[model samples]
Target chain A: MPLKSVYKLYQDMETEQSIISYKGVVSADLLTSVLNIMEDKLAIIEESVSIRKKVYNVLVECLQNLYHHNEGKGTFTKNAKQSISSDKASILIISKPADFYEIKTGNFIENQKVEKLKSKINHINNLDKEGLRDLYVSILNDGEYSNKGTAGLGLIDIARKSNKKIEYEFKPINDQYSFYCLNVKIN
Target chain B: MENINLEGTAKTPSVSFEYDNGTIELRGRSIPENSVEFYRPLNEWLKEYSTCPQPKTIFEVKLEYFNTSSSKCLLDLFKLLESIPKDKTSVYIHWYFEKDDGDIEEAGEDYQAIVPLPFKMIEVDEI
Candidate 1:
């Protein structure tokens, strides 16, 4: 896989602790594999259950976001190797910092939607835990009764767990597409 | 009602609930692929248990991990436990965490703050 080369590129960066990295097309199977790797690594850490759960939850939300917002045009067929268009491919990196785990995911987003996402993350980062919980409950109930999907609870969950501000950036790829980078620090 | 027993997976947890003794155990990881589907039966069973509860119900939650959706479901489960009459039914929650994991310990404390029930946070060795 061409993606293997991407992994090879990161192998040369000699760091104090091992840096586990994987670059691949975002799919359910790939998501599960990544979670398995993370769980295996986290198991060795004492008192990691809560952190493990938070990590798992955050990854799920990230993958689901990719799936829901995938800009790919072709339908995926069984038994057929569906090539992910360069614009549709998403990259996720989980790196262990000295004091925290840094989870970063980048994907193509429409140039127009970048501002909305940035503003949303900013707003969520400002709320306290109680406020976030109240917002979550309100959204859940409102979405359920109104039949609205994607109530933006994933961002709220991320904010609640990370307990830190979300750092993100948008790099313009072209007129129509921009690369969206989302970074969360779990301390 | 029938019992609910299932093993845990990398993204999900194991559940073993006996209707006779009302002892329910949730162990292992819990990050279900589809939180809605994974928790449907557990929620239904809890609904049933509410109507016909055992005298003493012991809930052991030894989860290494769970997603946000599962956290909501867990709160629901504890809320159900809080509903039972204190005299007719006694509920004991054993929240197990690894000794070094501060996150799990804090989670147990957070739940205790929310639910009005007898919940104990116990630190255990690696499973």
Candidate 2:
């Protein structure tokens, strides 16, 4: 493929109405900086306290997932190389409209993990509030904490609060990796 | 312990507790950056309150939304309420849900089923 064509594809993939977008290595420091900037922007919008809290939580969960799960460096485990660019990094975008705030994060994942993720989303989407609560409790009791102390409840919490279907897409990046995009909207 | 009063943040809920009256109110959204740090003191206050036990204790939960972590903390609070002596302390839990928010209403009911305290599910007009 020509260099120009590849560049065009990259740009096209990034097309979005991003109030805040970060493309590079994901780290706690970088995430904090982005959150600080976003908080200032959100403050100016004068959203209600509840809405503001929801937005902040959603952003934190998205960014932390990217930082912890991004399969970069020598850790080429599973479907790492295909979706995420070991050299290029991941992307996060926060957009706002009159009615809602949308947060989107894109990172690379293994092809094998896609099916499981899709199934999980489907299961969550099918649940009512009580079902979601039961699932959360069951998961809490069953699942071990991640290295970062995450209980794997982030997605469930997102689903519970959002009360909306999570939007996602997977684009083939290579043989082992594929770009994964997850979007959550808070109104 | 000193009274716990924190203004609500975008991700954190507003909290006001009076040690004297044993009256506490939690309102707004609760998805705190550090759930443990945010809830620890409140839990402590409840524990202390259980010992002295005010005659009338009312906990007004008017939260619009909360995440799973916050839900766990809430369950802890309700359990504390269950432990208090009924005669010495009369606990009234007023759970407020938005009129149109069926999810919140249902959640309130679920809590009522588990908690032994007198729980009332009240609907509030939408903002």
What C-alpha lDDT values do all the predictions have? 0.72, 0.75
For candidate 1, report its TM-score.
0.73
lDDT of 2 by residue, B1-127 (tens): 5678889976678999987877899998775535656788889989988988889999999987665556667877888888988887999999998766655676686677667778888888852
Tens-digit lDDT track for model 1 on A16-119? 24345555467768777776787677777525566766666676677667655655333333335653355357877777756777788888787788889888
Error of 1 at A48 (Å): 8.8
Cα lDDT of model 1 by residue, B12-107, tens digit: 788998999989999987665466667778888988888889999999999876655566667778877888788767999999998766656766
Candidate 1's C-alpha runs over 4 A off are A1-24, A40-88, A96-100, A109-116, A127-163, A171-178, B84-88
Highest TM-score: give the candidate number: 1
Worst 10-residue lDDT window for candidate 2 chain A reads A75-84
Please give me the DockQ of candidate 2 compared with the native complex.
0.14
Please name the candidate that would achieve the greatest DockQ relative to the true structure: 1
User: How far in Å is the alpha carbon of A43 misplaced in model 1?
Assistant: 6.6
